[model samples]
Target: MNHQSDQYYIDKVLDGQVNMFSVLVERYQSLVYTVVYRMLKNKEQAEEVAQDTFVKAYKALDRYRGDAKFSTWLYTIAYRKSLDALKVNKRFVSSSDIKEIGEENIELVEDALSCLQAKERKQIILDSIMKLPEDEAAIITLYYFEEKSVKEIVEIVNLTADNVKIKLYRSRKKLYSILHISRNEW
Candidate 1:
């Protein structure tokens, strides 16, 4: 691990030692890739987006002010890139499908999930999260999986705190619904 702060690496890169940029990429690639994979739900597309994210960040490194944490800024870029890809892919969710996963269904699945092995439960939750719409998946992944604060998510997704909270609520319902439907397959 690079003991130096992200700013130190950023400064090194900015000073023309571009190799320092690779260190930053190595540091955050998994984080960026995870955000993209959860939203895109495809390993190949997520890999492409993750690469593009670093390239874009390298080019735009000069414009980065010290306002947000480096991870948050990189996340904002990753989130936007995922949106662009989703717009092109045009994935949609059927309301009928969501409707099938009713309000009461969440608790039933929650109970069943508690009996699952830790790794199995986490994998199930992650798989269910991937089934969400792009925006919802991103919001939920940032909030729950990445443990980002509402304000941090607001900056990453460019949503208001209230908007992030509302999406978090809706995403959980949809995730539980998806889980309920998929439960029988396990």
Candidate 2:
């Protein structure tokens, strides 16, 4: 079912058919988990944050004005909850550690990346993304994997459109650098 139909289930839940809420959870759980996992990088913590996101959304269902898509609203909650978890756990990676690799190394890595099969290439890309800072990783995941527009991302991450644009660009560059270096190490 599409996100538009999410409103129907939401209405049912609000009207006291709470079991209908499970449909919303089943529909959105993966999207929410992806956002949290990209930010948290911990399976256990990401799962917890994802559950919390759904609970929070369920509790705040009455306030959902439908001005935005349900996925967008759910994503915003997941994003905020992930940030809160990051703050509490202090799991953020330091920027200084993300060093630039040499041009020759980059080319070697690029060649290795291209040589891999599709599934392997995807795994390598996910690993590289996980190495990035939380905000950059979230921006890349939301923009590329989830196909969220810059405006939708802005609403989710509370960044300006220009900032999201810049982050998407920089995050791609960073991911390339990471993939290249990681491939070389193999």
lDDT of 2 at 65: 94
Q: Which pairs clash inside model 2?
A: none
Tens-digit per-residue lDDT, 12-89, candidate 2? 999999999999999989988988998999999999999999999999999999988999999999999999999998
Candidate lDDT (C-alpha), each: 0.84, 0.85
Give me the candidate number with maximum TM-score. 2
**Model 1 pairs whose backbones collide:** none
| Model 1 local distance difference test score | 0.84
Clashes of each: 0, 0
Superposition TM-score, candidate 2 onto the true structure: 0.89
Give candidate 1 misplaced runs (Cα > 4 Å): 96-114, 184-186
In model 2, which regions exceed 4 Å deviation?
Answer: 1-4, 96-111
**lDDT, candidate 1, residue 170?**
89
